[model samples]
Target: MAHLDTLDDEVPDISPYVTPISPTNRFYRIDTALTVPQVDPESWRLRITGLVDNPYELTYQDIRSMRLADYVITLSCVSNQVGGRLVGNAIWTGVPLYELLQRAGVQRGAQQIVGRSVDDFTAGFPTTLAYDGRNAILAIGMNNEPLPTRHGFPARIVVAGLYGYVSAVKWLEEIRLTTWDGFDGYWVPRGWSKQGPMKTQSRIDLPSHGSRVNSGETIPLAGIAWAPTRGIERVEVRIGNEDWTPCRLGQAAGNESWVQWHRDWTPSGGGRQQIQVRATDGSGHTQSGRTVPPRPNGAEGWHTISVDVR
Candidate 1:
């Protein structure tokens, strides 16, 4: 867990929610294996095996030829600290996992759906997640373009609301259906929680940290907030020692996408000022105040930043 926590510093900061349509280059990527797996699409095959009644395989083209669906989903890494940039939103296009599993005829007593990457890194979630109507997919495209090699070239799994460790298996090659007691993926043994549900999170993008600004000038305090499968209902910002003030929200792209938010603030006196932000989900859940490090599960805490005004 200590090593995983340190990896958060390696991720470059990007305003994940500011642009719900995050550009491909700005998307944060964290790979467990030492080297990125090179997968030749033409030779790539997705194997469906294990407890299923019918084991089968599908090529990259075969997946594309199937009925395709596009969705704007936000992915958050469990290793992401409060205000971290390890989250991104993009329109993903792929075949539904439910449809694929149905075709394979998942047998009775099956309890988990495991996805194996070309690098041999594996991640699995409960079988119920595939059919839970949360829009799980075997994504082949991202932001209207083929997935970038570093971000899972051929295909990856995207499940709304879950942390990337549990659902964002990249360079995906195989899905095995098995029992709960069957196996543990890469992160499980590393001390991460099996069910990586994302916690409510928000960030401050503008007034770049440590930037000098004019005192008494009206400045926009803004950023993005997300609650995964549940949309962000509202965002609020607080100036040093002031009450939380509501901020206007931008149109959310989809139920699983992040929403943009901003509030205007005038600095009365300038020295060193701290800005804090928090969010409430559509389900009426507010971000927690107690800070927790990203470890066995996702992190929980309000995102705060400071800047100097001249």
Candidate 2:
């Protein structure tokens, strides 16, 4: 977690609103299984089975030839604690999972779309989310480049507004359709939520935590806010005894991506300053002030940060 620095005229607006992390940025990575498997693209195949009318398979080349869709999506882990750094944004390129499922002829009784990775790890979500107008993709490209090995090299699923545990299956190998009662992905039995809808979250990214600034110096307060598929409507920040003030929001790439925000602040008195930030989604839901630990579901509450002012 990088801290915010003293704002100077030469400093480019350090707000996420002014600049978003690039797709190729060093994103946080996690694997349920101990090992991250390396797969050969040429030999790999994506299997579609179970409740699909046409049980079939596609090789790397076969999938690449399909109509490729692009999206800038953010992925959050269900285990992300308050003010966690496990979330990231990327421009993903792939076939829409909804379209692929349609082409494969999903059977009428199919209730879940389960993704299987080469390592045998699996996770899934409701079948309706695939065709219900969400930007869910069987992603193969990231940041205009081939997906990186550490980030699910050959392919992965990019479903907006859901925690990675339920949606982002990395190093893909299969897509299986089944009844809701017939399946439990890797995380469900382990106590994570079955449907990992993302929680609205906001974070302070600048002025590295615990850093100091001179009293009365105007500083740039910047961070990012996200609500996934619903998008972010606004972000507000409160410093010391001040009332919440709206921060400027950056243009979002799509409903699934995050937006940067920032505000200029000058300290009235020196010592320690505590700041609280919250967000309202496009759906008109403001983040909860009540704090909850990340558990079966996502965490809820405002992110608070403190800094020193001499």
The residue ranges of model 2 lying beyond 4 angstroms of the native Cα positions read: 1-18, 23-25
lDDT by candidate, in order shown: 0.84, 0.84
Task: Report the C-alpha lDDT of model 2 over 67-156, residue by residue, as the tens digit.
Answer: 886777888888888778888888788988877787789888899999999998899899989878888899999877899888897999
- The clash tally of candidate 2 reads 7
Question: Which pairs in model 2 have colliding backbones?
Answer: 3-207, 3-208, 4-206, 4-207, 4-208, 16-260, 17-260
Model 1 has a clash total of: 0
Q: Candidate 1, 158: how far from true, in Å?
A: 1.0
List model 1 lDDT by residue over 1-310, tens digit each. 0001111122234344366577788888987868888889999999999988788999999988999878888898999999888989888888889898998899887898899998888888998988877879999998888888888989999999899888789999899998877888889988998888888899988768777778988777777889888889889988888999999887777668887777777887769888889999989999978999999898889888888988
